[model samples]
Target chain A: MSALFEFCLRMGDNTLVLGHRVSEWCGHAPVLEEDIALANTALDLIGQTQMWLGLAADVEGQGRSADDLAFLRDAWDFRNLLLVEQPNGDFGVTMMRQFLFDAWHLGQLETLIDSADDRVSAIAQKAIKEVTYHFDRSSGLVIGLGDGSDESHARMQTALDLLWPFAGEGFEADATDLELAGAGIAPNPAGLRAAFDARVEQVLQRATLSLPESRFAHRGGRTGARHSEHLGHMLATMQVLQRSYPGATW
Target chain B: MTPIAQVWEWLDAVPDPEIPVISVTDLGIVRDVDWEDGTLIVTVTPTYSGCPATSVIAMDIETALRDHGVDRIAIRQQLAPPWTTDWLKPAARDKLKTYGIAPPQPAGGPESCPHCGSANVERISQFGSTPCKAQWRCRDCLEPFDYFKCI
Candidate 1:
């Protein structure tokens, strides 16, 4: 696959997987406000996925549409960050995960606003506004819950510790990333690390939470080398209707 | 050949699917209207990427144009200079307030309750029933209202 197509898939799949995970909280969130907020965030991410995947399909010169790319691909064929595909453990965990991802996501989109490709730049331009709102909400929640009560603080810390290792994969560059970065189509993943770390440190400090000492990075999802067992289950549910019917539409 | 002004006027009659008080033109989604050869091209920008109303709004535009005897209509989606609350027409802001939804404010929150015009308001949530709105309640009136959040 071409580097551009791979880059698009990576961007699209990150949002797609994370959107699905957030949408899973629609009726299940601890409070009504949180439930609505999660759903809205999920919607925005899915919308971005449409643009990214649509571009990917066009670049591939394949007849596949965005929906086809989203539903037809198996877990091994997916290219999302391992952080996004991890389970939403609890309300605190979900917010922590979102905050971590949002920090990096915001930085990524800001840099992409100047991308070499007009399409990539346009999508980023549109998505950055929504992601800004997402970051605001997620980061605020992380702070509130982390510093709220003894239990909440403990939970937030645990969630951070659990999710921090997965965060590294987002900054690890592979050949696809290198080619895209070299071509100016996208930024090198490694270059985004400083901003991500700064944002995380600021938020975690205000939240009264400690960052995990180990930066031991997890690898595979973005490379399609391997994915956690959770991904297969998610894909099974997400692609079920399309896989079963083959060409169903509303 | 219909005049572009007349086509825009017809589009101004198409009500937003979610907020019926204001037309798509008033909502600032219709960015341009012109005739490209035989096709009537209407450029639109979505209020929010995932807004379900986007497709409905496009369909509504098509239906309204077709009813006006325009056969070849193309709806183009524009992403650059992304849609913002600043695009909302001033008249539309009044319409939104009068319709009980607070208009977008520069301060990032509702200035007051749309119903009671009370300045004492608290945000209930950063999100509401729709992607473009947020939930707020007036402390004075004790009524919850949706605010068209500044994007």
Candidate 2:
């Protein structure tokens, strides 16, 4: 498989799975504006997955459409980071995950905008703009919930500790990632670690939430061989339509 | 350019559903407007992530151009090149500012109010009157206006 195509699938799968997770909050956000905001962001992210995976299908020369990649793949067959597949525990957990990932994603997109690869650059130029607002909104919520009142701060702090392990995988480089990073189509995940840390620290400190010292970085969730139990449960809902009726298009 | 191309040249006049003064082409939402195999194909990007108006825009494009008798018109929604206010034709920006909604600030920078020209607009809400826009109030104008939030 071409590294770039595989890379695209990896990226697309992360958004696809997590977007589904976030969409579950459509009618259930604590506030109405946030409900619409998260759902809208989910729509954008899923749309982005379709584009990247469609291109991935073309590159793989497998006649696999975006639907095939998204709906056909089993939990173990997905290549997304473990962090994205982690369960959305509560609003606090959701915002924590979103804030962490959005911060990294925004920075990554900013760097990708000028990628030597034209396709990556084009998508990044567009996606980065969207993620910028996404990051701001998510980070804003993280701060609000983390430092608002005693109850709010305690709940948010607990969410942060729960999610800390998964956050490490985002910064680690695997074999395929290193290869793609060398191609100049993607930035080195290792390089983004500092930027991600700094941004998160700023938000956490403002939220009066101390950073957890736990560094038992979770890894090896990609390569399509294994997944958290969360993936199987999420897929039950996500793939329901495609699994029931194959090739059904609107 | 074929007669279909000629028709496309005419369809270029279709104003954006939101920004009526500017054609969809100038807004960069209309990625491709052309004829293929006796069919007219038009591609558009949603103004933001989930602008419900995209379907309206597609239908509007077809209804507007159907008068020319194009057998089939397809509006392919491509989200790869996400829509940006920067894509707004310069002319459209001027029209937007004149029309009361602030134009998007240039990319790689923070946005400013289209009303009182202040960088001090605060985001009041993420969803505006439409999905593509966010509710931002100009601290200077003390007036709430929509920021053409990107997707």
- Which predicted model would earn the best lDDT? 1
Q: Which stretches of candidate 1 lie over 4 Å from their true place?
A: none
The Cα local distance difference test for each model comes to 0.94, 0.78
Q: What does candidate 1 score on TM?
A: 0.99
Using DockQ as the measure, the top candidate is: 1
Docking class of 1: high
TM-score of each: 0.99, 0.83
Against the native chain B, what TM-score does each candidate's chain B reach?
A: 0.98, 0.77
Show where candidate 2 strays beyond 4 Å. Answer: B1-9, B12-23, B31-46, B49-66, B70-82, B89-122, B136-147
Q: All models, DockQ values?
A: 0.87, 0.39
lDDT of 1 by residue, A1-250 (tens): 8999999999999999999999999899998899999999999999999999999999999799999999999999999999999999999999999999999899999999999999999999999999999999999999999999999999999999999999999999888888988989899989999999998999889999999889899999999999999999999999999999999988
